[model samples]
Target: MTHQVTIRNTGHRFPAQDGSTILQSALDAGLVLPYGCRDGACGSCKGKLVDGRIDYGRYSEKALTAQERAQGYALFCQAKPLSDVAIEAREVRKAGDIQVRKLPARVQKLERAADDAMIVYLKLPANERLMYLPGQYIDILLKDGTRRSFSMANAPHDDEFVQLHVRHVPGGAFTDHVFQTMKERDILRLEGPFGTFFLRDESDKPIVLVASGTGFAPIKALIEAAFKKGVKRPMRLYWGARRPKDLYLNGLAERWVAEHSGFEYVPVISDALPEDNWSGRTGFVHRAVMDDLSDLSGHQVYACGVPIMVDSARRDFIQNCRLPENEFFADSFTTAADKAR
Candidate 1:
């Protein structure tokens, strides 16, 4: 059965085939919807369901809470319409024409950024170049039908190689291989350039960037892209980690601060041992932003990190810090354990 899906805001219409997700169907019809981690783990694709019923496919509880579902919200990436429906969702005009392809990549280099994090550089075929926004990510397709997603750490202008920061997850098959057994020059299949966490170029608002652990990957790309484009907007970055050493790319951020006129970097450490001699900002990274900028009404915030940090920042910034809800863009790094929950 085919159902007509209407966008209440734009009055655009598309056809949703039986068993097809709303996001997939929209893409098939050449309409773009803001989305990330199409597996129903990230809440980026969430939207208001104005009318009609849906299957409400399997999803992480954190992404779509019972309270949110009760409020008529659904994760379009996983929801399948039961009949013709109308919904309220933001269409991503910038990402509409970018194509998603499955291509082969060769491991060019592997640099150990930290004890638990590895920076892998992938080189695509000589004839192929992936055209993607700064904050997009690629999914490595495994032979066992599993996939691991990682954001590109390099900016679009630096497209000679795709850089990914992979954190070692204990007992994770992919990370285990990457840290222990993977060798240079190995071939891997990948698909993507996914996510809607890029900069809103049209907006001239000051930018606040928050990152935790490997979440810095996409933020790095975004900042570099902004710099490459000569975006003069003021930007501040707050990066958090359990220990100072876990902030693998700290030096690079420092370099950016030294080079960029309107850029600032703050390193926040939590759980730092006494012997480590830590003396910088300490506590949750998001709190540092709140402490410095009490009023974020005129700022655009970009956050990427674990679910706890992203969720807290989203709620606190909008409710307490006077930030507009639409100005807060985020990419939550959900793990296998997160999705299982």
Candidate 2:
């Protein structure tokens, strides 16, 4: 049985096949609702269930609380409609309006950005171009039917080749291949550009960009795209890593600070060793933000990287700094271990 699903404000309607989540069906029908870590770990797809019944599928308690569910909220990514359903959700317009596509790409080059991070450059067919918003990600389709998601590190304005910063996940099949076996000219199929973590251009609020480890990939894209569009809004980036070596693109960020008067870069190292002789901010990256900017009421924050860092920033900023809930955007990097839970 197929159930009809309607978006209350937009009046957009789609059919969800039996057992399919509302989000999956809507995306298949060309409606892109905000989402991250589609496995129900992120609350990006949470919305009001305006009408009709649904089977709320398995989801993390942190993503959808008991009180939220009792209040008629549902994680659309995990909710399957039992009947004709009406949902109230903000529809992303400009960034997600483009069609998702699947295409083949060849590895143009691979450079080691750090001991654990590899910068991969992929070239599409001569006539093919991927039109995507900054801060979106692509899922590399593996031969074994599983997919690994990596964000495009390059901005859309420089899209001659897609760039990805892949961290070697120990014992992971894909990362193992990328680090040890994958070679230049290797062909891979990919589907993208996904996620709703892009900049909200309508807001002129000063921006605070946060990234950790390889989570910096999408943040890099967002920053580059913002600069290319000549957005003069004050932008500050707080990049957190375990050690100084992990801030692989520190030079690039420093150059941005030198060239752009509106831009500021802060690198935070959490576990700097005595040998490292780090002389910058130390401690959790998000904490560094709180220390410097006591108030974030008028700022828009874009955060990506580890789930803990993203979650911490979202909670602390909204609870203490008076940042509006909607003003905080993030993409949490969830591993297979996280999904298993």
- TM accuracy, model 2: 0.95
lDDT to native, each model: 0.94, 0.92
Q: Candidate 2 clashing pairs?
A: none
Per-candidate TM-scores read 0.98, 0.95
TM-score of decoy 1: 0.98
Top candidate, metric lDDT: 1
Q: CA RMSD for every model?
A: 1.1, 1.7
What residue runs in model 1 are displaced by over 4 Å at the alpha carbon?
none
What value does the lDDT take at residue 81 in candidate 2?
98
